[model samples]
Target chain A: MTSMKTPVTLDLSAAKVVTDWTHTANLLCCRVDPTGKYVVAGAIDYTVQRWEIATGKKTVLVGHQNWVRTLGFSPDGKTLYSGAYDGRLLAWEIGLETPKPVKDIPAHQGWLRGLAVSSDGQRVATCGNDKLVKVWSAADGKLIRELPGHAHVPYCLHFVPGSHELVVGDTFGNIHHWKADDAKPSRSFEVKEIFYHIGDLAPFGGIINLAFSPDGRTLTASGLHKASNALAGSRRPVAVSFDWKTGEKRPKHESMKKEIDGTMWRAVIHPTGTLIGVFEKQVGFWNAGVPDVAHLAATPSDIYDCDLHPNQLDLYTAHYDGHLRAMRIGRG
Target chain B: MQEQHYRPCGDIEHLLGRRQFMGDLLAGAGLLAGSSLLASPVGAAEVAKRGKSVVVVYLNGGISQFESWDPKSSLETGGPFKALPTTVPGIHISELLPHTAKQMHRMALVRSLNTKQDDHGLANNLVRSGRMTQSATEYPELGAVVAKGLERADFPLPGHIATMPAGVGGRGNNAAYLGPRYASVTVGAEKGGVANAKLPDGMTVTADQRRHDWRRFANSRFRDKVDSVEIDAYTQTYEQALRLIERRELFDITREPTKVQDAYGKSELGKQFLLARRLVEQEVPFVEIQPGGWDFHHNNFEFHLHYVSDFDKPFALFLEELAQRGHLDRTLVVVMTEFGRTPRINTGYGRDHYSRAWSIALAGCGIKHGAVIGKTDAKGIDVTDRQVDHRHLFHTYLQAIGINSSSEFDIAGRKFPIADPAVGPIKELLA
Candidate 1:
């Protein structure tokens, strides 16, 4: 419902917007640092770009041979981990001038689907085509434990806070809860769908670009529409909320039919729990409590990634069309 | 047993003689004999001395426990199927497996196996490998270990043969960490049968013999000219390939009697299981027959009835044939799935994946016949006692085939434990 004009330079409206280095490479996945000082984006070129939240300067982290599929920031915000289709997880130190990989762990035999960092920063969990969710020592890149029980590829991984548990959703629509310390699962819940691919999990509400909610009380997951062929319509984005304690799930909120001509690339919860941002053709937002059609701003081309500034409720939207737009959230 | 009902023929004797001749040729060639084929020395002696083999009928998707092994006859969880009594007084199986129940004198049923994985991929990996997924290294499959421990190194065909699609049930069946050379030979749907594995098209015996002679001469010259380890490895693989070609008849099921073929069912899964029997009889240590499409999340009764009937006929026939041929005591037949379907039927009239408790059946070598181990609650919701996870299953499998499950493999300089450190074999299941 909103229309915006292209700008040569970054613009801040009634809402304070921050300037950031726009990326030329299409972004596949993005994560905000725990402290909100940096934003790490995995690009289609298999390189991870780390941007300083305050200055918008970028440092590229390179190692993956295939497109980086997912990214995670350690709890300490000192280390950045990226999962790629090349079946490797690369750990990058953010403090370095040019972000470089410190450890490269070949974690899966197939494409690395998801990556997550524990609350303590000591463990990192990853899952992929191997159907096993493995936890690694962030300190040494050594394998700590493996959580098994997924029949299909584990599409997303999330570490619930305050508990030693990790939640994994697979392509088969099954969600498993694995105890982080042990190599076994504590419980599992099945969503009765054919090919449900869980795209992302945001627990609690940090900005949409951040790791799971620091509290681990709530879980928000995005589902792909193409998982089941019996559905009459095309793939669309659906958001689900769950209580981390009781394992109770709320009715899913279905957004607008995913842009078939354009892919609904990424979805993140805004720092405020009420607002969730979905990036496809343009930047769109849906309120978690309200069951309404998501509204998107018109843009020149498909959007790849977007992030909210830590200090202000501003949005930084990046497009595959090689443009970055900084826009206000509240008003014109 | 009725004398005229079924009788052992002289075919087994002829096969034994052929096996003896091959063993003599192997010895003459100075190839390592029997258990010495194992890379590890820990169980080499015991494995070499033991002549046990395993035929695993892998039900790829989760098979419903209520419909198969732990049928709650009078309960709602029992679905529409009825449980029938077997020849063994107290033992019973689903009516679909009436043939198997008649032959229950040689089988042991584990009614309660509470494995953690309900997801197909994870459950398959865990159940097959008998270990949890570790981030540091890939775990070796139980079949791979069996092949490593018990198979002859110089044997022409691979010790482990899988006659199904890879990635059928998940990560469980792959020969992980065993390397590609030791990985199971996957025979396709049509060609996996014993008959189709013969010499290539348009090749006469005389021409084949001439080719073999030339290959031997060339190999001898190369061995004398180049003493490189890589060349030796290549030569060894080539020799193995030739040997497998020579024994191609072992894969042909048409060589079997018409009654035998009819007994195992005419379905793909049935034929595959028959092929597995032939492979083991030919001394291949481990053979995995994967039959998929058992997920049955909806239309539980109809789907299971169709699939289970297809499985039951062939499975029972395989067991009966093994017993009649006097190979049952030396061959282990295991029936397993990724996990069991849920006890409660959902709105779709299908059961979901349930990991809490399930069933697995073992017959033949080292297993206690007519024994039902473990138990589930009345509704089949949870394991009432004797919980067995993948670790236990792996341990039991190795123990049945005369290998120690506590063995470890060194991967990436770390001594990774092979099975779950917490669980061991169900001793009661072993004779």
Candidate 2:
């Protein structure tokens, strides 16, 4: 995996929206192919859309019957794996002129919320409303093992960098570490700082995503805390990081005290250890080594997911306003 | 034959005195004249239709057909929920209502409803009153009409009761021309369904009874001085309140066994539904339950995930309890909303109002069991067949209880049709 030697810097005042790409249907998730030729996003219309980086030529991939909320690309960027609310997982050959689904399987009984392709692109980890974390063979969509012990609905999952183990996040903000081949978790703990639960039900503000630093030393779990009106979508975004080896929480990135009216739907850790979180209103870039946000970039609309471009200096964000914005980081 | 059932003209007092159900209640209201109360002519033919009632489970804002009763999970606009098969074969509904699905044999579904109004206020008025709002005229709500049609003169309690959470409700302006007698009394599970129907800790029942007797004497004197509709109506209501106080046990579901209470669950809506079942048992005629907070214009699925659980089990349990207790034979239960949510989900992961096509579930009474009426196309944007509206539903509701919707009511010599004449009852739904 290519790592960014230097992530976006706020001291240089370099992050800004460089271009705007529009789709009439709102987009939910985003991913950039390693080839840097296309930026693909999942739209509310139940279609994954790919837009050419240069000419803005758009292609619609229609196979899923529901919102495609999670997307991942193979290391070669030729294969795209998508999980949708319809509980179906699809494998697509994006290298073709007309991208088509090559493999489709019923991955879960209900909403398939979280998915991650392994570093070697041979396996995929997924979790859904069924409270099951499953690892599947990426080649032919075969379930390898079902990781149990999630008492609540699992929201996000990720393969540890340079390792086969997986860390899963759930509605109660609990993170469970599972060995790739084992059904039982090696360790489990709660990120209580970013989660809110009234009781056994109406649980909101849990860990929506889990991201590991390039070196795999620190793990950042992102969601909302102190939800004032969870039903009205009122909450504040927060990302809490933990020391991987010792399981000690690093007391950084927890001081986002500004009460934003949305959730930190997703977060990604850069090679430089800067955690980028897309929230309801804007994208917040936090210095992972400190307790405060380094910079905040306002998007054209509230954002759901963000991915760094293959060029590393640029970012693509899927937004709630039916548009995907490209944020260019540079000397401009 | 139907017109003979409702004689709202003179001799109402004679008919009122004849009802054995109103014996103690009417005497407490000072509505019974001396000899007439003893030798009243009761109608034996009216027994079957007299106690028939209606219960409306109002879902407050718009309920998504895609998430509740009429899901088309494979379509582009179908959203995410799977359409699980109900107890009745060939009929499927949203998986979000699994508990309701188990009891589908007792219910009928109307899937193609085009009420035509999308705004909450407009659709609420249209859905409840069965008439579009206009400055020129207004109609009584379904609850008020039901209460007026089926309220037992013998069991005299609040005819229409709205069990609701704060803000999401329907007590005021509901009666319209039906008058205050039929207006809904706002009740809650937190407090008693009939507020303060108990004697003070210090006061004895004898003392309260004496006080009631003195008040009745005074009200009788006032009636003797001025025989007016206002006075008669006031006496009737005051007596009804007294009767409610006497039978206050009806409001306290705590009197029910712990297992019974637990079956209703701990959720607030569950308790309200328990209260509704209590009212249903006592023959209160019309009960409207408003769980509210369904205006999910944001986080629709997540919110539904949290919200539907609060009511689904209780809903299924209610039907189960009614059937077990034999009240289902005389009670018409309707589960509806102001309108349906949009098939096209918005950017906020929400759905706005869409009245073009939606659904409501009906059960018991005169409804045909396991019937599924009307159909929406592949996409639920519009009704594809047998489309019905609120007017037709209103006509059906009355017809379900043996009331002829085509009959005219002599409202103070100003004739009024019971239901809109433009449309008739949904015969396919009627037993």
Candidate 3:
């Protein structure tokens, strides 16, 4: 057998390219609203764009003063909350003329980096440069409590579906489990080996992006080598899976080779939760639990964000070069 | 009996000959060990009664000096929001906080906190920890120190507690370097059912009671096996947890009458403040309540109105209730943020982050109410006088509660000063 230089490779033929945003639309996130009618995307242009799934036409919700880092649609799809870098959390009523400021609790003293709304949409949790994970009431925008355990900045947060627990990832490559009630974390695990350390100067590197499979059985995280030489910009990407309940990390799947070169920005579980789309300089789709090669997609430039459509199996990818592309997947 | 003396080099003979001299040097270097050893009989007696408590309301995002406590009514930087007069003569606050203005007599407004860190994490750590930004060892939060210094040995509850807004963000709210035991007990209003302040459902009353008893028994057995200060600390933690369980009602704001709840506003922030009051009244030495989401890069006016409105009513009622209960004088309430929003409105019609000059307020306890400590330029850009930094801010809080900022704690066999060595409390604000 030929020597395998890479961990995984993807087949690009199955992906059918759809509409694309030429410029000013570096999409950061896409979510099919709870109603499954409109897909909303947080973009680098500091705007939240809504795409009609049927026609693929886009409408923009403009107001945020900085890059929109994360967005979540209310359970009814009528309300949307966008967390931005300018340290503001804004709320928008679907058809309203303008997005209204509901409860603007300066969530973090630094950039408002990441946000995750609970499955029920009643609680909204946010993590950022503050290095603290805060949980709030989505209905009235009141801060209910906070989790102050992480020593470094928390990059991502997700509420475990159907459980009163939250999984939080910090910049230090540690994943902590915080019970729904207690502000203190109950369990913690570190991925020391899988994570990269630039040197004594810059250590702490693990997964920056995390996504839980719909069934909550699996967790997919994208890893990157720590940037040792910032000027050299030599960052490589890798994907790892874990047993959500036991926190047992699986080996670096062999199927994902080409996708492991650049830094992975995001990993999104498809609607079915069986397929995950990983974004780096390009897009790669992999089947859950199979460890098979990821099917790579041809893209205009480096991919910064990707998300699955609310209902269909379509994928939306955003690029650093300011382009948003829509793609549909088909069976071989 | 000759007094026992110890030197940094661990030489007993040298320590005895120069005991007084070495003692002063060690104390100055923040290497003092054990409170009993430092105090002469007279000094020890004075230390016992002089320690006071503080309640810090850390507003995570920078609160604007112009809009909050130091309104520049005549300047172009003042923007559209107007200032309203308070109960104190010649004192005014933003129209947004009319309620707080009414209770101005119990508060002292510091209009010139000139902290260096404009960044949230650094500024918060600097102000809360009261150390220079690059200081090595993580300093204990003021609350943790109070917990260590003043918490009653028999008390079964955590000495320091923190209740913040769910999505409020920032750094320095943590109990750094003090270790896990002294970390603030975080209580949320939404998750973990803020109203149901108890063990989870699976843990029945009988089961919880058994767990508590068994934990105590196990700790006792372990203590007997290894007699050390660590065992005492662990036992104290266990007892605090037990006390928390017994006085769970203190954390339950829902148990209050509907009228009382309404007075504090039914909002999460209002309820959280109510919970904080309950905690301090129940004798938690320190409580930090963080209310964030104030960074208004665009539409700063509308954002502050919507957010601060929630704070206006409940905060006033909280102060009123505290004063009514005669706890205001013993409880120090501080309202501060990391920095402030920029005075200039940007393209997005928003104000970017500004750290040059900002406003912070303190009320109750040892603070002289109805006092305004400093002034900002007409445009609200710089501190005109009485400039304060993290050290001064922290020292003022410590002095309010009667803690000496010069107090030292030993870590890794080295003496670490609690507050910044350079700055002291703002004498003007102190009672």
Give the candidate number with the greatest TM-score. 2
For the predicted complex of model 2, DockQ is 0.28
DockQ of each: 0.01, 0.28, 0.02
Error of 2 at A242 (Å): 5.5
In model 1 chain A, the worst 10-residue window by lDDT is A198-207
Q: Sort the predicted structures by lDDT, highest score first.
A: 2, 3, 1
Docking class of 1: incorrect
Candidate number achieving the greatest DockQ relative to the actual structure: 2
Model 3 DockQ reads 0.02
User: Candidates ranked by TM-score, best first?
Assistant: 2, 3, 1
**lDDT tens digits, residues A2-47, model 2?**
8856544433276788878888777889999988888899976789
RMSD of 1: 22.7
Positional deviation of B97 in candidate 2, in angstroms?
2.8
Evaluate residue B218 in candidate 1 and report its C-alpha lDDT on the 0 to 100 scale: 61
Candidate 1: residue pairs that collide: A32-A209, A151-B119, A151-B120, A151-B121, A203-A213, B125-B172, B194-B251, B194-B252, B195-B251, B195-B252
Worst 10 residues of 3 chain A by lDDT: A196-205
Q: Mind giving the per-residue lDDT tens digits that candidate 1 earns over A1-332? A: 78874322222223333353567655656667777788777765667777787787878787887667788787777888999877899998887888778999999975787888877788898887677888898889999887776656677777877555788876555677777566566887655432331111111111112224335566665544433321112244455666667878767545545443222344566545544445445555566566544555555555555655553355666555434555566521
